[model samples]
Target: MIALHALQYSRATRILWLLADLGQPCTRIDYDRTDAFRAPEELSKVHPLGKSPVIEDNGEMIAESATILRYLVAKFDDDSHTPPRGTVDYWRHEALFDYVEASFAEVALRAIMPAFRGKPVPDDAKAALDIHLNYIAHALGDGPLLFGDTVTLADIQISYIIALLERVGLLAEHPTVAAYWAVLQEQPGYISATRTAGPMVPTA
Candidate 1:
């Protein structure tokens, strides 16, 4: 069994969804953000970074959304959500999984920071977001998921950034991207996670 340390409105929700999708059981410890919208100091006791989605399994601790996702898939996925290893599609899966945080999520966070601060998004930030959105749209061309109609771990990895874009209204103009998120929200695992973790975006 995995012990999940989850935080509100954080990438932890995606971890929970992944576990639910895999039908894996976990002992979840939920955390709430402070009035400043930061993780409470209590979380530091669980991990040095105090970030959510940290997992304690078999006496080993794991953190970072992408790292945790990879660990979970490799351990519990039973190949249901990942392609067979060493195939072209498998490499694509690995690349897209890393790309979400390294590229798209970074740009999405830049664009979202201004909105979260109650300021207008800068032209450059919007432009950068548009470039990434176009890339993602092309990557997902005419498919419900990144690879095809079936959802994969890469889609789960990318969900946080998509939720952020939707929260800041960046997805309004990109119908394809917007629709992709809609489909993700309809997943049963997503529904189960949100019922406990709330929405991907924080109300505050």
Candidate 2:
């Protein structure tokens, strides 16, 4: 069994979704950012940052949401359905995944996050975010998924970020983003993770 350290409304949801996709049984310790449950000091035993989304498997600990997702996919490759790593689609997926992850981080910090938290974002930051959004929109190009037809790790990771942006109403006027978000929300693992997270709130 895997042990997952999770926090509500964090990237930890991505790890949970990946676990569900792999059909693995895991234990979760849910933490909240509120005063009552500060991140346990003991968590450094699991990760350097003492943060959520740390996973323990076979006496080994791993942190970082993207790393966890890749680990689960590689560890359970036989049983889990995943795209072939050697294929062209896989390369495309990887490219898009990196682009979106990097872009979203910038946009989140600059535009989406501030708006979601009811804080004001600078006009310059919003403009930068719009440029990134346009890039994502172009990359999408009417495809059901990021790379092509099949769902890849890229889809799972990027969709979660998109969902976060959606919660903040950042995609209100982006039809392509809305379409992508709709398809992702229909996935069982995505739905499970989202339900577990409860209502979305803006937090790091």
Q: Tell me the TM-score of each prediction against the true structure.
A: 0.95, 0.85
- Candidate 2, residues 25-44, lDDT tens digits: the string is 78888766655435656666
Query: Which residue runs of candidate 1 sit more than 4 Å off their true CA positions?
Result: none
Clashes of each: 0, 0
Candidate with maximal lDDT: 1
* CA lDDT, candidate 2, residue 53: 80
* Deviating ranges (above 4 Å) for candidate 2: 35-46, 78-82, 197-204
Cα shift from native, residue 189, model 2 (Å): 1.0
Q: For all the candidates, what are their Cα RMSDs to the real structure?
A: 1.3, 3.0
lDDT of residue 161 for candidate 1? 85
What is the alpha-carbon lDDT of model 1 when measured against the actual structure? 0.87
